[model samples]
Target: MKKRIYKDIKIRKLFKRYEIRRRLLLGLINDLSIPLEKRMEFVSQLNRLPRNASKVRTLNRCVLTGRSKSVYRFCKVSRLALRDLGSQGLIPGLSKKSW
Candidate 1:
């Protein structure tokens, strides 16, 4: 789990470093007014970027337990963690569901 989190952190950093440049290249590549040669150049530039720099490489992980599945993006934790926190009243505005 720690390994997964560390890998995610590295991917996030790489994505941050290349996000703007990648988006620009992609946008340029897709523009119909751009010359074919220029678009190919943009494609080459996009391919030259590190694979991990792509946003798709980033995975949602639980901040407290490092679980990867069922993570709540807004809370940055997994489902179980969210439940535990809500039940303990640690999360403001979140309450445990009771019958």
Candidate 2:
């Protein structure tokens, strides 16, 4: 019997892009102190970037939010925004101490 190998190639690709965008947006939010509600708009702009952009190697949006903006504008996870996110759980794992 041959061993079977299962790999979700599509998911892997999507996740890779998601992670990149997530990190980039997080950094921008932290530095700019942008609100969560407005972050989506910024992310949407980035999602439209040309495919050649190295930061977003792939084109994929956050599944939870279902917004292409997730590809660019990430909710601020800094201590300042943590209090709000904590109460609302708007962005997961975004804690005051994470920064």
Candidate 3:
């Protein structure tokens, strides 16, 4: 639990640090106006970035329970946690469903 959260934090930090560089490199690489040689340099720079820094490697984790699955993007909590909070009337506009 804590281990997953810690690792998530570390990855998030790395992503934040390298995100701009990655975007810039990708933009340059995709620009047709740029010479192929220059674009190849950008591609190489993109490949040199840390694996965890890539957006695809980032985990969508529940902010409260640290669960990595079934997390609500807007709420940032797992479905289980969301149910619990909603039942307790903690989440605005959320209520128990009825037949």
- Tens digits of per-residue lDDT, candidate 3, 1-78, equal 999999989998999999999998888898999999989988888888999998888899999899999999998999
Cand. 3 TM to true fold = 0.91
Report the C-alpha lDDT of model 2 over 1-99, residue by residue, as the tens digit: 011111223445555656677667657656657777677776776676543444434334433333333333354233444455576767677455553
- How far out, in Å, is residue 76 in model 3? 0.8
Q: Distance (Å) between predicted and true CA of 53, model 1?
A: 0.6
**Regions of model 2 farther than 4 Å from truth:** 1-7, 32-40, 43-99
lDDT of 1: 0.91
Candidate 2 worst ten-residue window by lDDT: 1-10
Per-residue lDDT of 40 in model 1: 96
Question: What TM-score against the true fold does each predicted structure earn?
Answer: 0.91, 0.26, 0.91
Q: What value does the lDDT take at residue 40 in candidate 2?
A: 72
Reference-based lDDT, each prediction: 0.91, 0.49, 0.91
Give residue 74's error in model 3 in angstroms.
Answer: 1.7
Over 4 Å off, model 1:
none
